[model samples]
Target: MPRPRYLLALAGLLFAGLAAALASAPRDAGSQVFSPRAVVPMVARDEGAPPPPPATPTPFAPTATPTPRPPTATPTAAQPTPTPRPPTATPTPAPSGLRLQGVNWYVNTTGTIYVMGIVVNGLSTPVELVRINVRFYNASGQLLATDTTYADVSIIPAGGSSPFWTLLLNPPPGVASVEAVLGTYSVSSRPPITGLTPTVTNIYRSSSIALRVVGTVRNDSSATYQFTRVIAAYVDSAGYVIRIETDYLEPSTLAPGQQGTFEAIFFNAPAGLETNNLLIWTTASR
Candidate 1:
């Protein structure tokens, strides 16, 4: 059963051609035709034969898988946070013990009864919005009419006093007596006004004419004021208030370090009104 020698030679040539084709082709590791485990056999050699060339080391090395790490924040210097300012609140004050300091009433040319007075803050705390109540009586001690009036000053410090004026334009016939009393008020949280400094520079008063008072008020406070209300009164030599007149400064609003002027006029002047005994006062408001 010996095969033909020519057939054997042809098969050997076919195998040699395939080996040459594989040696000349390009290699793509991603999609190779041959298995990675395949290897060529070394040729047989005698003990005396020279040892085969030392195996060449591969230049390609397996790369290590990177270990993931948590992201680190850059170091930054700490900054201080400013605290917000709290809102200011107006609180109710303790009970205000107010007392009437000076009170006077008069009848003008129009038969209008004018009741004016001063309220003294008897408490140790500041008070605001002081008011006055006036009650009139006839000759028979009957109630004629009544009215309430607010103080010209909006705030009064402890032991300080403010003036109030009320009008009874229509009084019952035979109104003989009147009583001025203290009314409502509030305790204030703000400090008492000490910036309004009223200085009387001129005055005119006579028994036959109306009374006039001129003054200037300086804003000694560091804050601006929207109003500088001025009030004045003519006092007799016996210390009784003859008349009270209220006025506002010409330039009502006053900035810090500025001053304002005012003219107070009281018509139907009464006797014993003295220029030397004028009581001029002022209070600044926001």
Candidate 2:
């Protein structure tokens, strides 16, 4: 019986030791698992902190730029002006026929009188006077009286003529002088004769290389002759008149039995023997 009691005591002691060891091992294993899970959760919280400070937002930059433009043009300056030209002058005309030659004023025994002398140059054609007007003026340059008359007066058929009585005026008061005018008022104008016959003589050549011709003009009519101009024709050895020489006769007057000598010259003449014939014509007053 003693041995059986000793065996039961040993089995009881071993069961108690095994139960205590199993209980302590379970407590240490649960502590190691819980520590590793808490450490992992703490590391995750530290890694995701504040989302990295919101990434620190940067400023926006510009893309592309444009180019600049150029300036505009300016205007120019002005120019100068031009000058004007001058005008031309006119010429005067020559006087016609039937002009007043002279005037005379005198006081007679009857009353204050005026006398005037009239002249008409003879023409190549016959000229007839149809009217004559006489005007009297006083010393104060006032018109005293005017006398108008008409008559059939025949002028010599020649170029130049003498003084002829065509008008006579007698007025009263302070009469200074009388002006007499004679013209072809009612007569028709005659055609001028260009050609005439002349007698030539005494022909020679001068030292100045000019051909001198002297001629005596003969009157073709019974009335007094007045020579105006002389034209000479120069003839060569072939009997052909090649050139002409003209001479204007001023103060030309001729009587019934009187003749005038006319001289003419030619600058150009042939070396052969030559002859000259003259032609005389007239321009007279009516």
Candidate 3:
């Protein structure tokens, strides 16, 4: 029991305190559990809303996109280089037994062309049956005609030379050059005739148409010769054979220690011939 003024003061103080407490209270009503029955209504409503669609999780988190890497260069296989080869050298031809000495080309009377030349047996061994070929050419180095001839002597002695003559029956017009070559040659290993002594004399040109060679050959070997043949070679100043001739002795056979006289005559001997030589040999028995 208070006086009226005291009561008014007390009421005023209470109201002020109530207003301050209301202002300081929490704004979220969920922070305070008024009763356990309040949770039941909230849970019932959440079940009706389909549990908020299982929290609707985001698919992925946002992040900076990875920078693209530059394209890698592909490796290439290496190729092998080929090595170059050097050029091969050419070989030279081998030398032969006979060699060319000289060549002469002349247009004879009656419009017949002639090729005359000489060949030598450069080897130490004797070469026989040497055939020669002459090629005629024009001024333009083209082949015009060809001719063939045999050596003057039957057999060319070692280090000896022989002459060859080719008569072109119908030479091409304007023949200007000539080339003579030793076409072929044969070498004989046969045993040479021995023990025949030959004496040569009276070497002279007869009537300007024949060459006369007078000789005496004696069979000094043990074997008797059935046939004796005398061979003569007309030689030039250079010791090359110009012409060759053959002669046979009378009675054909000669006993050992028997002698015979032979007269060899050469027709159409060339003018440049200066000397003569004789060779006596017997043929082998059949």
Best by TM-score: 1
* Quality of model 3 by C-alpha lDDT: 0.58
Candidate 3 regions with alpha-carbon error over 4 angstroms: 1-96, 100-119, 124-129, 137-142, 149-178, 222-231, 238-260, 266-286
lDDT of 2 by residue, 117-161 (tens): 323332234444434555666666577777765432233233432
Spell out the clash pairs found in candidate 2. 122-158, 123-158
Displacement of the residue 194 alpha carbon in candidate 3, Å: 3.9
Return whichever of 1 and 2 wins on lDDT: 1
Looking at model 3, the pairs that clash are none
Indicate whether candidate 1 or candidate 3 has the larger lDDT.
Answer: 1
- The TM-score, computed over Cα atoms with residue i paired to residue i, of candidate 2 is 0.28
- In order, how many clashes per candidate? 0, 2, 0
CA lDDT, every model vs. true structure: 0.69, 0.43, 0.58
Cα error, candidate 1, residue 18 (Å): 99
Q: State model 2's lDDT.
A: 0.43
Off by over 4 Å in 2: 1-197, 224-227, 236-241, 249-251, 273-286
Q: TM-score: which is higher, 2 or 3?
A: 3
RMSD of each: 47.1, 66.7, 58.0
Query: On residues 221-241, what C-alpha lDDT tens digit does candidate 3 reach at each position?
Result: 887766676666544344333
* Candidate 1 global lDDT: 0.69
> Highest lDDT, which number?
1
